[model samples]
Target chain A: MRTKTLITSMGLFAMLCVVIFGLGVKGLALDETFRRFVLAALWVCTWFAAVVGLNRAAASDRNKSFFSALMLLPFDPALVYLVRLVSTLVWLVITQALLVLLAVPMLKFDFFSQPLMLAVALMADVGILALGVLLASATGRLRGGEALLTIALLPVTVPVFLAATGATEALHTGSGAAEAWPYVLLLGVCDAMFLALGLLLFGKLNEG
Target chain B: MKAKTSNAPLITLALAALGLIGAEVTLYLSYFYTPVQISAGTLYVVTPSSGSTINLYESYRIFFIHLPAAYATALCCTLAAVGGIAWLLTRKDAWQALIVSASEVGLATGAIVLLTGTFWADYAWGSGRIGSGWNWEPRLTTMLILWLAFAALLVLRRAMDTDKQRAMMTAVYGILLGPLYPLVSKAIEIGQTSHPKSFSDLLSAPEIATTKQVATIGILLALVSMVALRYCWNRLGQRMAQERAA
Candidate 1:
């Protein structure tokens, strides 16, 4: 069932991407920058939907066979979180790269020259996902888990969003990587701190 | 249910009230009576500056609210930690009460700090200069997260039917991770945006001698009054719970 769900979701995501790309090409053919923004927005929404879908799949009792497979598999939960983090990071980076690609034609400057922006975006996403997964795990145990998790996670993720957006904008404006490195490092440090703290406290939460 | 023959409550109340009053007087003197000075194209009129002085209205004036809130939040968190530790050691109801009260007050003060800080940021950084709306300043960010954590602690307590379980969990989290607040704040400070330094620089020489002194006293009094009222409410709550159990 989990495999089915994952496949269905992936298929849906692919379709959504194709539709967005088609729309971008048809309507905004000459406006590459605008196309990039639209594509990035679609990517962000798709990633969020995928996470919610996967979480729902995990919680459903109808997936007993899949649960057994998951249990038998050698993959650790932490590794699962890490992989999810990586996937989300890749999605965001792709969106960013697309934005830069389109911006090059419009802005008359090299948008992708600073590779560190991609690294920074990835770090920020890691911090965000770590915090998100921890809250989701906690809230998922409760009755109104998803709603509670949303409320609990949104405000906490504000800083990460701010850092990510600021650094991204700075990079686009042709700022040196060294200039924006501090914010990226800050995001990385926050990610590690929260991950460690969550792991330490999660055991207690699970018992209850 | 008779009162214990201890002056501890009275003393605490008095000290807290005194602190509040002192802060208030300092605020008055700093703004109303202090001389205004001009510096570098900006008019430096202290809080409650004289009516005639062209007050640049350096948004730092909001520090009157921000500083007290910061101090109160820090105090409450510390109290929560200490109370949690005491409860763990002694398994006493009084310690649990202390933890609950501290957490409540901490949450309230944290909210106030965030609000006032936003106002200050709006004035200093110009509205929407940092990020779109909210800037990822370390102090603001961590204070916010700490507030959420306390909120979670309170909700968890409410959700649990048994007092023993509630107290145990609250104590465990409070004592174990209380230090993380400062640690996280410090790391953010080192890694990210530049905000005011939290330590000694918070109270400058003129600030201490002037309107800040009055504001400090007023805040202390306000906090004392608030805590006293909360304590009374808590006592009533306990009595009702006991009556219901009986």
Candidate 2:
């Protein structure tokens, strides 16, 4: 089941990449710089999809064995949450790097021109995924969970979305990280704050 | 019982009407009675000069409506958040009703503010200068999302069959997501984008003394009227639901 979930998520990401690149090349006729922005957005979406997929799979497989496995794990639940958060961030960064490579040939400038953009994007993703996982946990236990999940999560993540869009724009304009770092920092602060809060609240909220 | 039950609705209607009258009077004074003034040391240029002349016109009228609606929405959001927290802590259905009422009113006022803001932005910023149409600036984007969130909460409430469960879940969302408004506003301000500052800072001396005061009064009255109406509607709905259950 886990393997199927992973494969389906990867397949969705691959299809998304193909469509985005095709549109960038054929439809929008976007320059390399703009293509990079689109690619970054796609990468973020891909990571988000994978995390969501994994969350849904875990939620559905709420059997005794699974709970036993979780109980037997050496790490604490908080530690597990941290590890998952870090792994998701790593996956997002890797996808972003891959996007940067694909975007390099079609662009007007090199990757080094917008180092801060990469950082901002990664931080924004971390914040989003952190909040997503938290809300997913809450909604996973509720009836009509998926719809409730979207409603609860989307508004909370608006700041991250705005920051990422702004940072991406700054990168394309070659405004440097100085202009965009504050937004990146804001996302980082929000991620850290919310992660801590979620960890503290998770036990109470998760109890049936 | 019917006579006694009807009194609450009557009182609510009377309060709403009085509040509406107050709002209208305030609007009249703001537009017709208030004197317009130029900025300090900034003279109006009749001829070509280095500085451009600023005019107070129809666009400024949006302020008469926008400020009050924005404040009202903020007030409603606060009330909703408080009510949600109260419901969570006390486990009271009355608090849940209050949360629902406030959420609905907040969503309505938010929509009004966004509409007025777009009109103001069109005239003030010049259409298409920022973006094609309704540029997704921070304030606008945040307000839009907040409005949608509240609307979704209301919808979720209606969809649920059991009142207790519905209220519980909705209250949780209302409390958790309520803070996003301030966060979004601060994030936008920090980002330094095309979102407009509230008119409190931009008014000239005469405009501030006359038009600003009137607008502020008008908005307060309107907000009171809307909230009263919504509160009454919520109470009525609760009563009806009780009757049905009985």
Candidate 3:
């Protein structure tokens, strides 16, 4: 059932992306600047959806999952949080891949040309997933949690978006790997920080 | 049994009075006593036709309050985060009060920072070719983020029904958000943008820095006073709820 839901969700998300970027915006025969702008808009939208979805996922786990209680019985609450974060990251990766697949055919971008950039984008998503899971879990059960989640999430992820965009832009221009790595490195650092923070605080947040 | 009355309101009233007085004194000193050039940094306005150096003169005086307010905001946020951790460990109302109060104060100060900053920017740059008066300079961006995070903390607090749950959740959020302040500072240093190294660069004279420090002390006292008042209010509310229950 979960798998079916996941597949259906991905299909709808892909269709939505195609509607927005593929056909909605003059069928992607846009100038270089406009194309990149559309790409960025899609990037933000993808992550935003991931955050919203993950928040629901985390909340449902807490309220509905039998394993949640079982998992908490073990001394290591961190393991449960790790599992949730990893699962969220996996879902994000799949959705991101689906988005890119739809985007590539419609937008006509050379994916293989910038393998390094693609890796950075994926890692950046991992960072977003870490943040999304932690924050979403932290606020998910509360009233007005969704709005609060977006408010807290967007500002914190500013650096992530900034770095990721810069790196991706560099890659698209076939700029040397040198220009791109700094941004990627920044993303990596942010991801590390988010992951560490999630591990340390997720249990505390979930307790009450 | 009748609940014992808290002296917090009385103390906060006194502190608030003193804070107001100190603020007035600081304003007087900034205007009359401190050197303009020393108090306000060197201001240069760039123009398309010809680049010109412009001194802000009396207009630069905003920094006296602005700088201290900004500092107080950061300090309050730190205190709130620390108080959050302490609250979690001790499971005490006092710590929760500390977190909630400091967060409120932080939000107020953050607003002041943005407000005064806009006016100061207007004086410095808005008058010139750069009419926008607002720039996404790294520091400004980070400060804006800090403000939003704290605001979110307040929203989170409102969402919870029980004090214990609210305290626990907010404390955790506070700690998680705390690192952003220093991290943003570091990121700004690495990814250079147009914010100055320090707002006090114009304070070349020792006397100016001294006056600024004095103003900071005044602002800090005001912040503490406000925090105390807020906590007392929280306590009173809790007591009222208890009384109703009884």
Residue A180 displacement in candidate 1 (angstroms): 3.8
Candidate 1 ranges beyond 4 A from true positions = A10-58, A61-126, A157-163, B1-16, B36-55, B58-61, B77-99, B121-210, B217-221, B224-246
Give candidate 2 misplaced runs (Cα > 4 Å): A4-8, A24-36, A43-55, A58-118, A138-148, A200-206, B1-11, B35-56, B130-133, B159-165, B192-202, B205-208, B239-246
Global lDDT of model 3: 0.71
Error of 1 at B53 (Å): 17
Tell me the deviation in Å of residue A35 in model 3: 4.6
lDDT, residue B170, model 3: 79
TM-score of each model, paired residue for residue:
0.65, 0.78, 0.84
lDDT of 1 by residue, B77-129 (tens): 77777887787678777777777787788889889988887666555542545
Predicted candidate 3 versus true structure: per-residue lDDT over A1-208, tens digit per residue: 9799977887677668766665556744567876676568557767766775776685676578644564458556578778877877777777777777777776764555777967787878877777777777756766667777887777667667767876877777667688888889988888888888778777776673
* lDDT (10s digit) by residue, model 2, range B166-225: 666667667755666686457446554455443333454465456567666666666766
Model 3 chain B weakest 10-residue run by lDDT = B43-52
Please report how far candidate 3 places residue B231 from its true position, in Å. 2.7
- Model 3 residue A23 CA deviation (Å) reads 6.8
DockQ of 2: 0.36
Query: Candidate 3 residues B66-183, lDDT tens each?
Result: 8888887888778877887786688776777677777888888888888787777666655543446665545666777778877878887787767666777778777766766675
| Residue pair clashes in candidate 2 | A32-A106
- Looking at candidate 1, what is the lDDT of residue A78? 60
Model 1 root mean square deviation, Cα atoms? 7.2
Winner on TM-score (2 vs 3): 3
